[model samples]
Target: MKTSQSYTESGYTHGHSAPVLAAHATRSAATSAGYLLPELEPGMSLLDIGCGPGTVTLDLAERVRPGRVVGVDPSLEALEAARDEASRRGDRTTDFMAADVAELPFADASFDVVHAHQVLQHLQDPVGALRGMARVSASLVAVRDVEYRTMSWYPDIPGLDKWLDTYRAIARANAAEPDAGRHLKSWARAAGLEDLQVTASTWCYTDPESVHWWSGSQAARVSGQTFARQAVEIGRSRADVEEMRRAWLDWGASPDAYFAMVHTELLARVPARR
Candidate 1:
């Protein structure tokens, strides 16, 4: 609700990831599969890195009933939104804090499960963050990230390439790394994590309409958070943005349209019991 859509120095101004994740199928996967917390049982502690809007935290807390869940995020806006939702749910077991993922305040081996989704791709030092999570978790460290640099497409949609370029440019303009997804497994392994397991997942939207629509929708959502902080001169237009969005969706929904969405994650056990 900030009046100006000017791009900010932070690149990603709003906590848009939370919303996108909340609406997408990935959250459902977490809800059903426990998001790689297989060894976990009730009363175990859980930590969510970059916990936007608290949806995953609250839901996981519910899953592991009578257990405490802590959601940590760096964005005050995301924390505020999460706090409001937690209060409304009257979930006393769920709590959120404003904190950096790389420098968690919790004690060593404090949690049983430490989970992060689509987080490392935004980090400049993903290995450091994983090390932090490894230090804090007593059992497991799970990380899910998308390789943004691997995002590819076919057919020439007007403005499609520009959108990706601007998006990557804005992301790199900030202190963030835009290609974080390229080697998530390597980073997790490099973080001193052994017994590592990695999985590759893909979401193919062949609806032609919905697949492209999904892309456009994603583009619009990301650009708003990524580019809105710029001055008016550098700000993207709503109309142009909408056009790209429509094109994307139209492409997705078209008969010739095909989409391959790739995401990867790593699950590792704590190497040492401190």
Candidate 2:
């Protein structure tokens, strides 16, 4: 579990602000964890690392009924929100805790499966984190993350390009990889995980409602206090941040607006015990 030091050391770019939470609350198992669904059974204990609002965790819990589901993160606000979500969903079995990925507070082979969604990109030591995951997981470890640079949109806006560059710079400054999707294989190999299977997926937002929601939320995220403050700390002016917000809003108003984010998911089996 995360002590005060580990929690304080986590350089999560998107703080648990309303905007960030709102955006993350949309995640579900079908949308984010489909690649791992086929392998999940009704009685496999699972650990969700970096489970933000517990939306996806709850969905995954539903898939593994009667099996223990625990979601862990370093953010107290996020853990509270996750607990609230679990309660709202009437799910009594799932548990939420504050834990660091680099030092998972679990014994070896503690869970049948370990999963993380859109998490590796924000972590400073993803390889170390994977090693911890491999240590705890008895059978499988699943992870998915987006390649920020692979994101494509319709009617390309200049500010969107600037947004990508600025965001990448800020993430790198935090010692995190903004394009973590492409590195999962190498990280898993370095962590000594075996029998790796990798897959790719995309979230396409073309419908009017989806486009509007995605764009507006992104605008809020870029203009939010956490990102805005970090941007400035990394030499990005307020004007630059405003341009990113405007670009998202402008894209939302376009009748032909489209956005697709590419994600990579990896499932690796833990090495057998002697």
Candidate 3:
């Protein structure tokens, strides 16, 4: 099958209805992952940066139902989508703000728990963005991201490794972080964030029986298509492009399709006395 035919047209750009992308986005927004938000209290303020579709925003609201939660992003589409979702959930305490993370409009020290997930990897000045989030943040800041370099690869396919490299090269050309886990910590520390800690994890694609495979397939396909597109634009031979695409596709089907990637949880404090 043609790579395009096998992959969704949106290919995880921003708005795609692919099952894989939807699942991954949903997981990022879940409240179960809110452990990093230590500043969250019954009546404390919370902010979600790049709050795509307001998943994390809603999650934050649940933590501080009586308190206020704000979700901010530059994309009106994302803000509207998040609003629509909030409306469906009847989450009145949560509000969506259309703004840039790099330049927030909020007053300094306004929020207790400022949370941003999967947003830093795409930024030009990730450190600057972290500083912006840290500035408006009251006491605590937490950001989560993946390390593409540590992305687990178990298949013994010879060509697959080369394809991975090619795919990564193309991704960087588009001004996106090909590997963001290690960079997340550096950015946080450079932003003058103290008490920084990094927690790493690996989400794998197990055999067909593995419940995560359903979601992993979407990620693999989206990432694979991204590589394929870059390969075409970068003048890689069509055969080489197809080889990489196929490896990624087969990765999803293989019983041993387990990839380990690094993740981080960065924290800092803003003194109330200061």
Model 2 lDDT per residue over 150-255, tens place? 9999888999999999989988877778999999999999888779999999999999999999989999999999899889989999999999999999999999
Best first by TM-score, ranked: 2, 3, 1
Worst 10 residues of 2 by lDDT: 1-10
| Cα lDDT computed for each candidate against the true fold | 0.67, 0.89, 0.66
- Candidate 3 regions off by >4 Å? 1-21, 28-34, 37-39, 158-163, 207-229, 237-241
Q: What is residue 95's positional error in candidate 3, in angstroms?
A: 1.5
Q: What TM-score does each of the candidates earn?
A: 0.77, 0.96, 0.79
The best candidate by TM-score is 2
The TM-score obtained by model 1 is: 0.77
RMSD of 1: 5.2
Per-candidate clashes, comma-separated: 17, 0, 2
Ranking by lDDT: 2, 1, 3
lDDT of 3 by residue, 204-239 (tens): 545565425543553455455454565677677768
Better of 1 and 3 by lDDT: 1
Whole-model lDDT, model 3: 0.66
Q: Give the clash total for candidate 3.
A: 2
